[model samples]
Target: MRERGFRLIRLLEYAGLLVVLIATLAAAGQEIALMYRQGRVTVADLLMLFIYLELLAMNGIYWRAGRLPVRMPLYIAIVAMARHLTLETPDMNAWTTLAEGGTVLLLSLAVLVVRYGHIRLPYRDEDPDNIGGRRS
Candidate 1:
């Protein structure tokens, strides 16, 4: 009975993942429509779209591999910061831009560190199903 319950849970998880993936696709389509309506695509808009794409890709990768790498979101963060700079170009007070850029740099370093740690210390026995994914 316990095994059957576990299987049922997995099935439910798969269903949920599918729904999310479909929503991601739908969102992408909406973004395209929005871009068309806007007449001109700015750097910030492009970066925002890139972030969305990365998020969808990450979700897919995690569903398949049971794990998500740190680098993907780090890349997204860098893009997001740049996007912010572009979006706020007219209103930027040097100090705020500096702070945001600094934060991006820090997150970039964190991505490198996380990559190194993962490579040096691969997933261990504590990993559920040995897939290097969420523990629960």
Candidate 2:
């Protein structure tokens, strides 16, 4: 029974991953179409595209390794906050702009911390075949 439950949960996880992959691809396609129609891409659009790419990367890494790194989401968040700030800058108040900038700064710091931890303290049984390989 326990094994069957585990299998069921795994199946659901794969199904969810499939949904996420499809949604990300569809959104990316839509963005590209909009850019094509407009005949030019803005920085905000580029930042949004980066967020989509990061989401796709996160999904791919999880699908391949059965684990999602903490950094991918941080990268996505940083790009997202930047995109928001870019799009809303014209109408945002000074305090709001400063708060958003601070949010991006905090996310950047989080990425640094995560990277530092991954380098200074890693999993004991790290997989040799993984992309970064085992860290000493």
Candidates' C-alpha lDDT: 0.80, 0.90
Give the residue spans of candidate 1 off by over 4 A.
1-5, 125-136
How many clashes show up in model 1?
0
Tens-place lDDT per residue, model 2, 30-103, is 99999999999999999989999999999999999877899999899898998998899999999999999999
Candidate 2 Cα misplacement greater than 4 A, ranges:
125-136
TM-score of each: 0.77, 0.86
- Candidate 2 lDDT at 2 equals 67
lDDT of 1: 0.80
**How many clashes (backbone N, Cα, C below 3 Å) per candidate?**
0, 0
Pairs of colliding residues, candidate 1:
none
Native-vs-model 2 lDDT? Answer: 0.90
